[model samples]
Target: MSTRAPDRFHVSSAVVLCTPGAADRLVETLAEMPNVEVHAAEQGKIIIVIEGKSSGEMGATLAAISSLPDVMAANMVFEHAENLEEGLINGHRTDAA
Candidate 1:
């Protein structure tokens, strides 16, 4: 039996670049995953969020989606709390008058 519990899933964000005319197909494929969610899209880019039990599982899912012929790249934009907190804290400073 495994003694370690799976890593808890939370909010994750990534930017995916799709091949020409492949956004629809890419979104469709991503939609198939149980916890994967496509939040936004533009010209040839897609913004997605995923909830998984572990980093490995999330990576596997992202890899699967990115490996699709229509996908050009799937770069993670945000995936952890520390990243967000730092950005948030920096954004709101006492100088913002």
Candidate 2:
């Protein structure tokens, strides 16, 4: 018999650069995507956070963002992965003995 590991949760943050005039519209568009959250926008720069089940999923989203109109660049700044089966208690991880 084979057992599969629990799904891993991925979190990533990116900085997107866009035309100053397009900031508002771009923010609205990005905010509508699943697992994407627009954190801040100012002077043509946008900060966003994304959550997904895997690195591929997050990379796909980043690619999509980079392809959007008026987006000059979407650079991933940070990433974190958490194993779902890791001694989690009430959504927080506990040290194992």
Candidate 3:
């Protein structure tokens, strides 16, 4: 059986910081995530990517990350997957008149 990775673009939010250092600590806090990808690290800061299915899940994930001492701040870079989704829900026609 082959397993495919989850949608990367659908990434809800990220936990960014200098460094948590302790894998055990990070693991305990992010036990929900079966996997984690570390992008870059400097001095003691690093970027962690989180994949959440919904906004509520995303909020919880961020909260857990924030509780970590290493986390400086976590912010959602993009909202709601994409802008076009927002437009359609608001009743804006994509077909330019």
Best by TM-score: 2
* Total colliding residue pairs, candidate 2: 0
Worst lDDT 10-window in candidate 3:
1-10
Best by lDDT: 2
- What's each prediction's TM-score? 0.70, 0.86, 0.48
Model 1 quality (TM-score): 0.70
lDDT of 1: 0.74
Model 2 lDDT per residue over 1-97, tens place: 2255667899999999998699999999999999999999999999999999999999999999999999999999999998777876555556983
Model 2 residue 73 distance off true place after TM-score fit, in angstroms: 0.2
Q: Which pairs clash inside model 1?
A: none
Query: Which ranking of candidates, highest TM-score first?
Result: 2, 1, 3
Q: Each model's RMSD to truth, in Å? A: 8.8, 4.2, 9.2
Candidate 3 residues lying further than 4 Å off, grouped into runs, are 1-9, 13-15, 19-32, 79-97
Tens-digit per-residue lDDT, 1-97, candidate 3:
2243323224553545535575445544555554345555455444566665556666787776777676666665554454323324334435542
- Residue-wise lDDT of candidate 1 within 49-91, one digit each (tens)? 9776666777887888778787889887777533223323434
lDDT, residue 15, candidate 3 = 42
Q: Give the deviation of candidate 2 from the true structure as CA RMSD.
A: 4.2
